[model samples]
Target: MPSFLRWIACRAMLAACLAGIAASARAGCEPLTEDGHDYVACRFDPRSDALSLYWRGADGMPLATTERLADAVAATGRKLVFAMNAGMYDTALAPIGLYVENGRMLHRANLRNGAGNFHLKPNGVFYFGDGKAGVMETGRFLKARLNPAFATQSGPMLVIDGQIHPKLQPDGASEKVRNGVGVRDDGTVVFAISTEPVSFYAFARLFRDRLGTQNALFLDGSISTLYAPPLPPVGGWRSLGPMLGVTAGP
Candidate 1:
């Protein structure tokens, strides 16, 4: 073989080897962060292979989905109050959206924060919802089997056996993503990033599969933001959007 051809072959083999190594490393274990919060920013680990929940904080900051509850917890020192959407909004039962109400899943009033009569809230549990029984719902199919209930909505979703479950997919599809933030009854907030406008059906399915919650809903995406500390300019921890996430601690 010619010297030039031999060299080219060697380089191709090297590139192939590098690519394989990179892929292996990427799949070794789930990615996570621990700047302060108790969960990974954008990764979910599920107990069963059926569904799971995943999240990724800003590059260097935590997403501020629950800023309201976190602040209240630090200030008043009381059991907070929140509302839920369960992945359905409009009067027509259009996928669940967020609304703040205390004691009920679809409360729509928070005069202090200017969220009144609106179908959405700023900070609440953001996850997939069944769109059937509002918050505190069970999967359409899995209700008798896996019976999964989420504390919030912070991951994509999945649908199995004609039922919804909280699940995550790294490269699912553009239609499955929601460009918004979501609120849950328990106060968990999910900041979503979507390549396009997600709908009620798709959102519900993705939320169920990826996040393991049959009743996960959509949250503010695209313009969604996060904020955190110990930021780096060049590489390492960074926020997803312009908003900052500051955990309450002195």
Candidate 2:
């Protein structure tokens, strides 16, 4: 074969391979049904994508909706690709536990016991810093003493170190719209939300068994929602506290 022809063939193959990779990276949320429930699972490579947390705007009020966030990012010449409520909040729409955005701590970690899911023991923190992402028990995270650029603390870890939370019953009666985040083996970030009511055990399995994430943290329930391209708008009665979003690079 001619050397020129061989070089052209090699270039074509390289281009095709690059196109395939781009297609996989662009694959976002998709419907996933399991255990008689509906869910939307979105996957992104954290190592390559830009992930950040948002709460208040210049006005010192929670952005609340994705539309507001989109507009805010647009003003900065960036595009918000996706976003979701990051954790539970109080009546005032403030994060109930640890909340950090852009390397600033907004709320300290909560370790006290109380009513509701946030108090559930073994709660954990989902965080990213130093170009890596992780989910660890709140106590373990505190003990490690590592500071993260973005962090959100929430309760009753769904999957811990490759094992589902012991407190999560296999067939519990209690169920609600739930959402959470997990980190895969390759450091990819996987976010999932139940479109229909689902038990904690089932939701955890989605992350552990299906998404292949060894450690996963529950973000919130009932008020859980996601905003991304091609997904219909989600209306809520109250404002959201902390939110996790992926944005386009400058």
Candidate 3:
């Protein structure tokens, strides 16, 4: 065989071996802290339906709200945790959780434009704001713009993150209930089709299946924000409304 070809093969083999070792090391330990409040924290159990809900804390730690939570699982060492900003009472109410202001809930659409929208849709991320809503074709349209390694053209079926979910489609227009994800009666995660100007609950759900969630409830929606390292993996986090949190090194 040609020397160049042999050398190329050797490099490929070495890369594969390193990846295997890394995967094994990552799998070594998956710890979910118990007791004490975590600035960044999340929970999942073998018995449960691959559930995941993560958030940052006001104590100045990582939080998870608007961003997709599954990516955190693939990240090594970092953990996804959840918290509620009871301080922000009522800001706005989406199809899911209540929006809050200054730790108090408030629901005034005119307050902010991009306040309640998720950019990515199953097809692609659409534009939503300025008394206008954005639209995209589908995954095919978004594939080019999204990170190949992290983003998928199509969303997961069955269960989104371990909870039973329903197949959702976008309801674009003033009926901007465009982004939608579902949960099962037994508590499974179902994702909504991606849409431009994403909606809250676009990739979120809560199920009653897990013992921990007897009466599963949805946390935050578009106002939700997640803070983990290597920013801009899937979506970016903005300082919107109140953020429920659990963090690290706090």
Please count the clashing residue pairs in each candidate, in the order shown: 74, 0, 64
What would the TM-scores of all predictions be?
A: 0.27, 0.88, 0.26
lDDT of 2 by residue, 1-250 (tens): 9999999999999999876655454447788887778888888876777778998888998888877888898989987878889998987889989998889998999999998788877999999966799999999999999899999999889999999999999978899989999998788889999888889999999999988999999999888878877676442425788788887746
Off by over 4 Å in 3: 1-46, 49-180, 197-235, 240-250
Question: 1 or 2: which has the higher lDDT?
Answer: 2
TM-score of 1: 0.27
What is the RMSD, in Å, between candidate 1 and the native fold over all Cα?
Answer: 16.0
Model 1: per-residue Cα lDDT at residue 69: 28
- The predictions' CA RMSDs to the true structure, in order, are 16.0, 3.6, 17.8
Clashing pairs in 2: none
- Residues 73-104, model 3: lDDT tens digits: 33534433322221122233121222222322
